[model samples]
Target: MFVETEEFAKRLEAMDGLEREAAYEAVVRWFAENSGRITHHMHLAPAHTATTVRLGGGEPIVTDGPFVEGKEVVSGYAEVEVADLDEALKMARSWPACPIVEIRPVA
Candidate 1:
């Protein structure tokens, strides 16, 4: 599932440099606590752009922005396979910072 902070984009864009750093740090700490259960974690840099391109000869599409625009962009995300969505949500709620966790089934 994909977990991210809701409204993060807007909040981050409005925050000062120091506040952004602090917020990022808080998120990192949250992930650290659950790192063992996570298959992998990736930090999305601001420079990254959104795109819709299939690996094989599927389809190519363009989008205006990331799937969602909020106070915080998905600065980072973790991959986890849990028994059920409820269990995944439980882990998401454990995050110390105020994050909007988005749960998406693996395709």
Candidate 2:
């Protein structure tokens, strides 16, 4: 897990109804345009939290927040496939308001 703060989310949330519609449309267009690199995208549930199970037969630890303690919590994720690490890093850096990009290879 990683953490960084970006103001883009707050700005988008502050938009009025019509403005939000326009913004959503633009995002759809952008996603379509970058369909190859974007691959799959979905927003994480806002009420999501983490629960830890202990191996010592002890009580499980639960938190009302992210399981990982870091400067950033993953609000969402994207399954992006790029040419190589360099390309992946470049694409990650290009995100509009991504404060932290956690790139982990799926097993």
Candidate 3:
């Protein structure tokens, strides 16, 4: 149940108005309705820099860039313990905002 997007991340950080409160309530209600199967929900912040690194005998070299660029970047994720991916997908489909959901198993 990972909601991944920079836009969403920004919204979460600045949720302080009436509309934001309503939106938060709606999301909470949705989660509450499906609380029976959700064990937890977590958010992850993505690094904006490239992860590629070069190792050499002389010195360690680092690159200043990201692996890829796109209009929508993964800002965070949510972890949901469910029966399976199908159940997770169903829950994700019910999300009111940010239609994108990245489902992955916890290690």
Candidate 4:
């Protein structure tokens, strides 16, 4: 799912230790509950760790940071097999963390 970095930071900063722990558990529980629908999932490293590659012309260009500068970056992704787009939307809407969840179809 895409995460708004600033919003995520703010969210964590507003929570106490106990609240943070609870929030973590809520996310874990969400994953557990949707395990059947999820085929694969992964949480990516911070945007700063990203390596961007651009191919064009005669040579390829490599960069040290994310491909683009934006309010939201893809922090994680999940491959879910649901009956329809509505079901996918429902799942995304219930995500416990990450202010933004992007639902896209796989080819």
TM-score of each: 0.58, 0.62, 0.57, 0.89
lDDT by residue (tens digit), candidate 4, 1-107: 55657778677899999999999899899999999999999988888899999997568898898888776788889999999999999999899888888888998
| Ranking according to TM-score, highest score first | 4, 2, 1, 3
Off by over 4 Å in 3: 1-16, 44-68
- Give per-residue lDDT, candidate 3, residue 103: 75
- Model 4 residue runs over 4 Å out of place are none
Q: In terms of lDDT, which candidate is strongest?
A: 4
In Å, residue 2's CA in model 3 sits off its true spot by 3.5
Model 1 lDDT per residue over 4-105, tens place: 454655666889999989987886787777777789877665524655343445665555566556544555567886889888888878775545567777
Pairs that collide in candidate 3 are: 2-78, 50-65
Model 3 Cα lDDT, one tens digit per residue, 32-74:
8888877766544465644646677578766765444554655
Question: Top model by TM-score, which number?
Answer: 4
Q: Which RMSD does model 4 reach against the true structure? A: 1.5
| lDDT of candidate 2 over 1-107, digit per residue (tens) | 22334465566678899988887676566567667886788766542455544445586654566565654556777777777888878766655443677888766
RMSD of each: 4.6, 3.6, 4.6, 1.5
Q: Relative to the true structure, how large is the alpha-carbon lDDT of every model?
A: 0.66, 0.63, 0.68, 0.88
Backbone clash pairs for candidate 4 read 1-76
Per-residue error for 62 in candidate 4, Å, reads 1.3
TM-score of candidate 2 relative to the true fold: 0.62
Local lDDT at 67 for model 4: 88
